[model samples]
Target: MKKYFYFLFFSLLPFGCKDTNGKKPIEITTNDSSSIYLNKAQNKNTKIADKLKYYKKSFTILKNQENDSITRSKLFELTKELYKNNFEREFLSSVNLLTKLATKSKDSFYLAQAYRSKGSFYKHQATKDSAFIYYTEAEKILKKIKHKEGLSLVLINKSLIQFDTGDYTGADRTLNNAYLISKKNNEIDNLYAISVMMGLTSLETKDFDKAIQYFNYGLEIVSKNNNIIGEFNKETCLNNIGLSYQRKAEQKKSVEDYKKSIEYFKSALKNKSIRTEDPELYNLLTDNLGYSYLKTENLDQALALFLESLKIREELNYPNQIVLSKVHLSEYYRQVNDTAKSKKYIFEALSLAKKEKAYRDYLNALKQASIIDVQNASTYSKEYIRLSDSIRNVEILSQEKFARIQLETDEIIKEKDILEDKNRSLLYTFIGVVFLLSMLFVVRAQRARTKELMFKQAQQRANEEIYNLLMAQQDVIDQSREIEKKKIARDLHDGILSRMFGARLNLDSINHLDDPESVKKRLEYLNELKEIEQDIREISHDLSREKQDLINNFVSITTNLFEEQTATHSAKLTYFMDSSIKWDLVKNNIKINVFRILQEGLQNINKYAKAKTISVNFRKENNELHISIEDDGIGFDVSKKSKGIGMQNMISRAIDCNGKLDINSSKENGTKITLNIPLE
Candidate 1:
């Protein structure tokens, strides 16, 4: 394990690690060569407290080298150490190197290595989008290389990225892929990493059994290896196993595993003290210590460790880790009932998470805030439900958006194929048409010896020309009619509708005269004139509006006839319609059909038998027109009355618009006429 550090250090010696004059050196000793001197100098320097300093020096050197496979491999190792140590500056520097190196290398192995490094860096940074970018890039390269071990690493990296990105399903798939690859290659160390990632992925998804299985598998391998990497991974797996139980609501079992995991983390932290080269591991263990406390519900202890971890993170200027600390602190305060303080910290965390688009941290903060609100049960229930629904909606929308995008892509490909097929068909048709025309022209030339043939050709040409002209003219006429209808409809509604309203007002004033008989006669005449005026107004409006054109003046004429029928024919009239809508704008044909039908309806109701109670109603819906008129007179069975001309005419009008006409009547109840028409 320690020998691997030498390989990494040497790989990074060309960048900022300079000679005496502070200039980049052209040639430098490899990490293997430098190890001997480093060991000797360690005793001499005395203050060379950790391996981090050598790794940091190595990282600086690699940053100055032009992007290449060697630089990527070295920087990847360096960054991993930096991430583990919580050396943010060194970690960032190493990531920068890897990103640059990746762009310059066509070698899939190098690209995969660089991308894997980048994924790790962003994972620590808590930027899911950035991490996903790197992980996907690494996946592509690993796929190209067909290196099972390398592919496993890429998959594990991707799995962690997915977990952080709130793609639990994707994380599970990626972790499983890594596990399968590790098993296939018989790579125990690779399997160790894969298993740990798989365990964490399952834990996050609350699959306790799967998480336990993965963790136990990883723990066994780590026990067999008995190395620092293996030991650290094993502890992480244990911690994750505990989290799984907690998520499953098995709190007691969770606490037990958490305590054991903390012990392992403490042991790992001790590695920094003895190795002088393991600052990265020290920082990682410290962070994990805080996390373990949080998991165990030791809020105060968790807060203290998180604060301490943050101090190191801030010193390193790690933006992502600082955000994480705020989140943990927020959770601590929330758990302790410090609502205001929790809110402040959590909002700060939320702001940073949103700005960085860090899905993992954002979800964490959102969940904590939601829990805090739950204390005010009555007050916060609605808010809690709203927040919960919003989170679920966003997740569902994201999944749907991805699915929709894929579906659209598939559609586009299909459309392209269809277009290509159409183009080919068109080409063939054009060729056939041209060939037929050519043959006809040739035959015509031969037949030109006869005047009859010439005359027939002229007639055919003339007919074709006339047909084209008529089609063009029809289009022009339709457009002109539509425009005229709109203009006329608007003009008549604004003009005649106002006039009729004024006329009705004038007639109402005349009703105030003192002479009873004269006043009654004048009012009766005014009412008849009013009915006529209304009918004219409706007709004008229908001519202008297409909607009214279909209605056959049902709205205008029905109420008038019902009122007269009640007054003259001794029937009671009841009309119901929503006053909110402008009835005159109903389709003209519909209005006319309904008006005529209503006229027939009133005649039938009046002439049939001695009765009262005539009712007319007009209703408009989103996509259909409705008119109903009923009379409580001597009624007959509708099927028996189907032979009536009025009924047949009504039925024909309804069918013209592909509508439905229902005439429901019984001998004693009433005669009801119902017409429904689909509207454009």
Candidate 2:
């Protein structure tokens, strides 16, 4: 009987607690389902690993295959999948391969795809600037090719980066572009992401009702799609909706809204798809739910949920989330009249918040401490108010930054449109002139009259070209000045103002404390202020250095042109400028004309001289600026090409600068050009 009972127990163990192999059954609990979720996640990761292995093998094989459009497309798809799977190194390798193949084949489609993939990689790595750059490049190509879907995708990615960088208005504009393309192409996924980002921006600006509507729209899309990823997005929408409700509740102090927020959070948490795919979201929902519970005065449930949120954050080792959880826990203890526990948790939170520079949490802790400690309430409240004002100012500054970005983007778009229109008008005018000239030539073939007319036309064209060039140069100079001004403004706004604000807050806090630690903190802040002053001096020095560089702009331009000439042509170049020449004293028109002469001369050399060696010289002699260029090549006969357009232009440029030009060239002796301009 004893043996039979033991056998029965052992046999029933597989169905009861232990499996046949003696391992415990996978347990699912309402309080903690982390183990089961992790197991499922591990299984999914294993599958991803297997898929990555297959992809790697296939990628290697495809690399050896013929580099055709179809083959390249397959490779890009595989690389994108690698990116999605978080195979970062492998994705980069594949991107490099695609880039090389595309460049070698001159395939724009593959190149655009490669850029998009690179952007996705950077996006995954959270390098917003680089990701934005690559996405912009991809968008340029896609727009050129009129690839509607690809353009929409790239724009969406760019908008996401803009959102991350706090360019909320700019993000909205970018998303609008993507929205139009996606709507035209019926790209549901792209539209879904755009809606969510729009909602997030609205949420950030406290447009709760608008945010809720956007979230609901996104949720409706996911509901229609009904895939695993769609379900995950649905959960995200729900969570965001809950967040909006929670904000509304705080504003209105409505217990009903808080209860609604808790319900939504709980519903989002119950979605099994989110559990494995986004554990961080799970933690966030839990934390928000805890806050909602606290607002509703459900003390026991709030405490339990807060502890759970803290456990998840601790496991993830996310400092920000952990600090937030601690703050909530401290608030909970305070509400429950547990003074000792509240003080302990508040102090812990304060330390972490200060270390993280999370001023909001730090201020919250100070307020709580003031209430509990009583003796320091006035000091704590004063510091809290000061810090609050500083934070509000910073928020205003950030909003202004977003507005500035929006304005800049709008200006760029307007400028682009104006340029396009100008180009179109020029094209139409050119066509009309060509038609008129053809009729004139057909009707009147008198050679001398024709020659006179042609000369007058050429002179008119040259004057127009010169006027346009000067205008462009002036515009460039103005733009550089504007950029410098903006840089100085940013330094003041982001660096000096922020540091001074921090110092003021610290000073306010110092008056309340008499401890050695407080004195030490005050000294540290003073040192920081000194460092900030030094930084200001450094920035001023940088500005001065830039001004000096601008003063030598002539030399800089000449050097850049020479380097470009040497890089593009087979010729070796030697260039010299006399150190004694005061470039800053030269009039702008003189400098521009001299630069143009050099440009025309070098262009002529490249086209006609076939130069193997070139030399350029600039100097001042007898209160006159002297410039010369010489080339050792099979020089053209200057007598035959004396009336050439290039030579005429060079002479005209010199004349415009109140200078004289001399050209010496022969087939056997090579070529040399010289210009002399009076300094006065």
Candidate 3:
């Protein structure tokens, strides 16, 4: 039969050189469930050491395999067998291989499953931090893939590890997330795990109703599966459920579940030949059963179970468990009035716990030991307080070390993030510089075109200005000609024409006849002479009014110039003058030049001085008419800078008008120019 199975195993193996070609050797088949069953059929020993050795040897061979999905699946199947057999070292290797293969294959579902298995293994081994890391990694991956079943399994595993670490709130929080996902996907196994976690957390928090509900649900699942491990786990949940009830003062119900859990555990022990068992699990059930018996004052049965658990823990070489069993045994002896035995066990527990640095267990032992003799009780009480203080100080030191480590980790992460940000910023800056160079080239080309357009605009403006100046000069010449013509015509009509008409009247009087008709004709000729004199007066008045209108138009042009300068520039302009200026005394040419000078002064004030206040003053100062324009704004060095055409024109106009223009300006003060012209 061995030769036939060997043939089958070799047939399953891929044929290749058993070396660098990555071909799996034939030894892996011995690590599978079929081999275990074959060993059982042949009635072999199946010891833990032998099983562990076989799996480890098999892993060496499997790693050389080409590692396809089929090879990965075979490895995972072998992992399940090793895990069940509790081959810790080989089990971890198999888990790692599966995880690596799943990642390499890019199979998220398989990777998540491998992580869950590894985390659960760590949890069973009591390594909570490692368990939580793997569980969280699996959860994040499964969530992204929308693998609800895988996500629920990871969450339930995380919740269990949280419970073990005494984090009841965190355990319940994770259980709630798992419960929602399990319910959505109808995952019975994940739901069972969630219910068990909830029951345990509620029991820890002293919520008896919630604890019982969840425990009952978990027990129902175990009953359906009829799994020995599941049944063992259900007993633990039931025991906790009972403890919760006892804490709540529901003694009757508490006793019922405790008795039920004990009965189930005793049945589990009976079937031990067919099923693999953990020494720790057996010790837990014994301890809890002993506790239940002690609570009910069943001393004989409690003592028996406590001794059994103690012997098992001692045989397993678990120091903490041994200390715990000793402490409980001491309590049992003290209750039975066996003072010597009680003191002996209590001291043993204290010494063992203190040696192991198990401060909590030491404290519990001290509390129990204090109850013996009154004198000893007081001494033990003081010792307990001293130890408590020492333990607290040690915990504080541990916390500071943990905090320092965490801070260093955060700083490292921050530095990494800053480096990443600098890299991104450099990339953006490179892009921006490239864009700016392109834009600069575009702008340089555009600027050349703009310069050409500006040259054309300057030429066009010069031509326009020359044309406007000629038109203005023509207007002035035409007005002068019209004025002279009117004056000449008026002189003829008023002086020469009127005098000639009077002479004609005198001649008519000399040639008069001695009849009534001659007399009437002479009267009519005198009337015509009077009408001609009136016409001459009207023509003279018309010429004088026209000359006055020309002067007014010149004043109007200056007013408009001032308005335009004020509106268009930043300067606030103010023009104030007496409505009745002695304009008739000023010659037409002088009036025109005065108006031009004021217009230029207003323009100069706006351009040179960035003034907010500009004022044009036109008032009579004694016998002189004074016109001043001032700006309460920035003043510059006028003498240092050459004057522009506008400023030169203004000075020239003042000189022509016989106006003494005195300018006073400073940088700190503002510019004020005064024009003093004679008003005689």
TM-score of each: 0.36, 0.48, 0.44
Which consecutive 10 residues in model 3 have the weakest lDDT in total? 12-21
The sequence of per-residue lDDT tens digits that candidate 2 reaches over residues 1-680 is 01110111112111111111123323333232322332343355467656666667767766787887656766665665566567878888988999999889987777988887787777767675667667776776667667776787777777766665556777788888989988897767767777777777777677888988888888888888764223366667788889889988998889998988988899888877665676677778788899999999998889999998899888988766777888788889889989889878877877888898877668777877787768778988898999989977765665565456446655666787799999999999999999999988976877766798889999999999999999999999999998677556544543465456657766786779989988987898899798778768877866533233435687886787788677546889999899998888988767756765676777667767878899999989999999999999898777787575556656766786788999898897899999999998
Predict model 2's lDDT versus the native. 0.73
TM-score of 2: 0.48
Model 3 bad stretches (over 4 Å): 1-68, 78-101, 223-229, 232-237, 249-322, 336-338, 355-360, 373-680
Steric clash count of candidate 3? 0
lDDT of 2 at 184: 90
TM-score winner between candidates 2 and 3: 2
Runs off by more than 4 Å, candidate 1: 1-105, 228-239, 249-375, 386-680
Q: What pairs collide in candidate 3? A: none
lDDT winner: 2
lDDT of each: 0.61, 0.73, 0.67
